[model samples]
Target chain A: MNRSILLQSRPVGMPGPENFEFREGSVQEPQEGQAVIRTLYLSVDPYMRGRMSDAKSYVEPFKLNEVISGGIVGEVVESKSGDLQPGDKVIGMLGWRLYNTVDAGSVRKLDPSIAPLSAYLSVLGLTGLTAYFGLLDIGKPKAGETVVVSGAAGSVGMFVGQIAKIQGTRVVGIAGTDEKCEYLTRELGFDAAVNYKADNFQEELAAACPNGVDVYFDNVGGSVSDAVMNLLNDYARIPLCGAISSYNSTEDVGPRILSKLIKTRSMIKGFVLSDYASRQAEGMQQLGQWLAEGKLKYEETIVEGFDHVVDAFLQLFQGTNLGKMLVKVSDPQA
Target chain B: MNRSILLQSRPVGMPGPENFEFREGSVQEPQEGQAVIRTLYLSVDPYMRGRMSDAKSYVEPFKLNEVISGGIVGEVVESKSGDLQPGDKVIGMLGWRLYNTVDAGSVRKLDPSIAPLSAYLSVLGLTGLTAYFGLLDIGKPKAGETVVVSGAAGSVGMFVGQIAKIQGTRVVGIAGTDEKCEYLTRELGFDAAVNYKADNFQEELAAACPNGVDVYFDNVGGSVSDAVMNLLNDYARIPLCGAISSYNSTEDVGPRILSKLIKTRSMIKGFVLSDYASRQAEGMQQLGQWLAEGKLKYEETIVEGFDHVVDAFLQLFQGTNLGKMLVKVSDPQA
Candidate 1:
C-alpha cells in the first residue's frame, strides 16, 4: 500500500502536524518510459515553510488536500524504459509518499558506491550546492577575513562555515544552543561559536569577529542579523540564502538595511539554488572531493517512518534538529 | 577677502539655514605646487545632509565651525605647477568659498570649449558618472524591460531615464509635480511619467508600468519607494542611488525588504560613484560623446552669489530644483 501525506489546510503561522493528512492506497505498475520507486528518505528543509503560504514566491504554494512535495530519494523496484532497471536508486522532487511510479525523466539515478543514499539528499544535494555557490560566488570570502554565519549548525550553515574555514577565513557561528555551538567550534574547526539564545550574544559575537565581518552568509534573519550587520567591514558581501528566524512569525521584522549597505559600501544578494544550476556540477565535484577526503563532515537528525514525515517537517521551525534533518522512510529493502 | 559658510551646529531633525554661519578670510598666495583659484560654481547636493551630522558615513561630517566643502568649479588665477596656468578652468572638492589657493594636483583641468565650465559641475561630473555606472552596470536594464526612476526630474534620475530609453527600454519617471511629469514625457521622450504627489499615486504608477518594473533607480526611499517596490518583476534590479524622501525624517520608515527580495529573486546594491574610479574614464568618455552629439540634455537651477549657497543646499529637501542645483560663487571672469 502507498502511504502519503497531504497538505490538509493552509497554515496560519507556525504549521502543526494537524495541517497534514495521511492517505493509503495500493501501488500501481509503471507505464512506458517510467519507473516504480520505493521511498528511501525524505529531506525536510526550512525553505519549505515559504511554500505553505499562498503568497507569491519562487515556488508555488501546496494545494489543499494534495500531496506535499520536495526532494526525495528512493530505489527503483521496476522500470519500463531502456534508461533504468529494477534495483537502481534515484532522487527527485517526488514527494512524501511511500511509493511513486513516475517518468524516468523526473528522477536522476544515483550510484550507491559513489556516496551514501542520504548524502545525495544532504551534503551532495541542494544544501551543499547552496553553500558552495553562495560562499564562493557571492560571499567571496578572502583569506584572513572574518565570515559570520547565522544558524551555523543547520544543513546549509554548517557547510558555509566549513567552506569559509577551508578558504582560510576566521569563522564565527551563531546558533540557538550551546550544544550546536560546541559542535561548530570543536568538531567543525570553526574559530568561534556563540549561542544566540544567550543574554550576551551580541557582545560575544562582536568579540569573536574582532576584525569585523567581510563575508556574512545569512541563513536566519531578524535581530540576530541586525546585530551582525553592525560589524560589517567596508566592501562586505552578504549572501542572503534564507531567513528561518522570521519564516513562521506573522509580524514583519528586520532592521533598516539600505542605510547600512550604503555606509559600509556593502552588498546583499538573495538567491535560490536552482539559479545556479548551470554551475551545479562544478560545486558537486568539489563537495564530493571534500567529503571523500574527510575534510567535510555532516550529521543527520533522523526520524524513522512514513508516519513521522510531517512531525520532522514541523521540527524545522522549532530549531529542534541538528545538521540535515531527514525522515528515513522505509530504507532500501534488505 | 574670501567668503565661506561654516557649520554652526549639528542638526537634530531637518537642518535650517541657522545651522550655517558666514565667514570672511584672506586668500593665501600660491606655494610650490599650488595655484590660487576663484570659486565659479558650488554643487549643492542632497547627500550633503549626511555630512552635516557628526555620525559615521561614506564621507566625514563637516567639522564644526569649519568651511563646508564639496564639489566646486574654479578658475586658476595664478600658477605654481607646470600642469595649470592662470585662467584655466578646473574642478575639485574645495569649499563654500569665494577664493582659494590649492594644490594643482588636487584639481582636474576642464576645457570650456568641450563643454561649458558649469557643465563640469553638472552633467559631465559626478552626477553623470553616477547615472552611467549605476544604471548600466548595476541595473543592467535589458532591451524591452521597464525602467523606473524616482526623483525623475533630478540630475542623476534624468540621465538614468534617458540612458534606459537609449537602450530600447520603456522608461517611466516619477516626479513631484505635473510640470515636471510633463517635461519628462514630452520634452525628454520618456514613455510615461507619474507625479508621486498625486492622490492615486500607487494606481497611477501601476497603470504607467503596464509590464511591471524590471529596473528601479531609486532616489527617494519612503512610502513612494514602498509603492514602487510592490510592482517589482522577477529578477528585478534596484540601483539604490538615494533615499531623499527619508533623509530628513527623524525616524526610520520603509517596508520590510528581505522578504520582497526573496519573492522576486531581486537585488538592491548601494554604491558611491568613486567606487567605480577604475571605470570612470570609460563612463566619462561615453557621457562626453553623448553630450557633444546632443543625445543628452541637462538643466541647472543656479542660485547666484556665495551668500546663497546654504539656502540652495537647504532647498534640496524641499524638492525645489528641477535638475542640478548649483550656487554660482562668481562669473568665470568679469
Candidate 2:
C-alpha cells in the first residue's frame, strides 16, 4: 500500500495538520522503461509554503485533494529500465508517498560514498546551489567586508554564511534562538551571531557589524530585514532569497525601507533556484570540492516517520529546526 | 555684491520659504591660478533635497548660514590663470550667487557653439550623462524590449526615453500631467505615455505597457513605483534614479513589493552620478553625438531672475517643471 499526503485544503494564514490529508492506496506495477521507488527521505523547505497559496508566483499552487510533491530521495525496488537497477539510490521531484511508479528518467541514481545521500537534497543540492549562486552572483562578498545573513541557522542561510566566510568575509548571522546564535558563533566560526529574539537584536547586530553590512543574504524578511537594511554600507548588495518572516502572515506586513537602496547606491536582486538551472553544475562542482576538503560542514534536524512529514514542514515556520530539515521516510536495504 | 541663499533651518517635513534665508556679500578679487565667473545658469535637481537633510548619505548635508552650491554655467569675468580668459564661457560646481571666484582648474570652459550655454546644465551636461550611463550601463535595454521611464518629461527622463528609442526598444513614459504625457509621446518620441495622476493610473499604465515592462528607469518612488514594479517581466532591470514622490512625506511611504524582484528575477539598483564619474566622458561623448545628430531633444523651464531661484527649485517637488529646471543668473557674452 502507498501512503501519500494530499493537499486536503488551502491554508488561510498559517498552514497546519488540518490542511493535509493522508491517503492509503496501492502502488502501480512498473510498465516498460519504468521504475518503482520506495521513499527514503523528504526535504521540506520554506519555498514550499509559497506553492500552497493560489497566488501569482513562479511555481503553481498545490491543487486541493491532490498529492503534494517536492524534492525526495528514494530507492528503486522495481525496475524495467536497463539504466537503473532495483537497489540504486535515487533522487527527483517525486511525491510524498511510500512508493512511486515513476518513469525511469524521472529519478537519478546517487552514490552514498559521495557525501551522505541526504546531501543531495542539501549541501550539494538545491539548498547549497541557492547559497552559492545568490552569494557569488548577487552578493559578491569581498575579503574583509562584512556579510550578514538572516535566518542564519536555516538550510540556505547556513550555507550562505559559510560560503561568504570561505570568501574571507566577516560573517555576522541573525537567528531566532540563543542556541542557534551560539551554534553559529561557536561551531560555525561566524564572526558574530545575534539572536533576533533578543530584546537588543538591532543593537547587537549593529555592534557585531561595526564596519556596516556589505553583503546581506536575506532568507527572512519583514522588520528583521528592515533592521539589517538600515546598517547596509554604500554599494551594498542584497540577495533576496525567502521572506520567511511574512509568508504565513494574516495581516499586512509593514513597508520595506526602500529609500536606503537609493541613499547608499546599493542593489537588491531576487532569484530562485531554477533561475540558475544551467549553472547548477558550476555550483555543485565547487560545493562538492568544499565538502571533500572539510572546509564546509552541515547539520540536519531529522523528523522520523512518513506521517510526521506535515509536522516537519510546519517546524520550518516555527523555527524548531536548524540547518536542513528532513523526514527520514525509510532506511535503505543494507 | 554676490546674492546668496543660505539654508536657515533643516526642514521638518516639506521645505518652505522660511527654510532659506537670502543674503548679500562681496566677492574677493581673483588670485593667481584663480578665475572669477559671473553665474549664468544654476541647475536645480531632485537629489538636492537629499543633501538638505542631515541624514547619513553619500554627500554632506547643507550647513546653516552658508551658500547652497550646485551645477552652474558661467562666463569668466576676471582671470589670473592663462587657461581661462575674460568672456570665456565655462561650467562647474559653483555657489548660488551672481559671482564666484573659483580655482581655475575647478571650472572647465564650455564652447557655446557645440550646444547652448544652458545645455551644459541640461542635455549635454550632468542630466544627459545621467540618462546615458544609467540607461545603457544599468538598465541595458535591448532592442524590442519595452523600456519605461518614470518622471518621463523631466530632464533625465526625456533623455532616457530618447536613448532607449535610439536602441530600437519601445519606450513608455510616466508623468504627472496630460501635457507632460503628450510632450513625452509627441516631442520626445516615446512609444506610449501615461499620466500617473489620472484616476485610472494603474489601468492607463497597464494599457500603455501591454508587453510587460522589461526595463524600468525609476525617478519617482512610493505608490507610483509600486504600480510600475508589478508589471515587471522576467529578468527585468530597474535603474533607480530618484525618489521625488516621498521626499516631503513625514509618515512611512508604503512598502516596496520586493518579492516581485525575486519571483521574476528582477534587479533594482540605485546609483548617484558620482558613481559613474570616471565614465562621464564616455557618457558625454555619446550624449553630445546624439545631440549633434538632432536625435535627442530637451526643454528647459527657465526662471529669469535670481530672486525666483527659490520658486524654480520648489517647482521640482510640485511637478511643475517639464524638463530641466534652471535659474538663469546671467547671459552669455553676445
DockQ winner: 2
Q: How well does chain B match by TM-score in each candidate?
A: 0.98, 0.98
Q: lDDT winner among the candidates? A: 2
When only chain A is evaluated, what TM-score does every model earn? 0.98, 0.98
Interface RMSD of 2: 1.9
- Where model 1 places Cα greater than 4 Å from the true spot, the runs are none
True contacts kept of each: 0.44, 0.62
Q: Per-residue lDDT of A131-223 in model 2, one digit per residue for the tens?
A: 999999999999999999999999999999899999999999999999999999998889999989888888999999999999999998777
State the local distance difference test value for candidate 2.
Answer: 0.89
Residue A165 alpha-carbon offset, candidate 1, angstroms: 0.4
The collision pairs in model 2 are: none
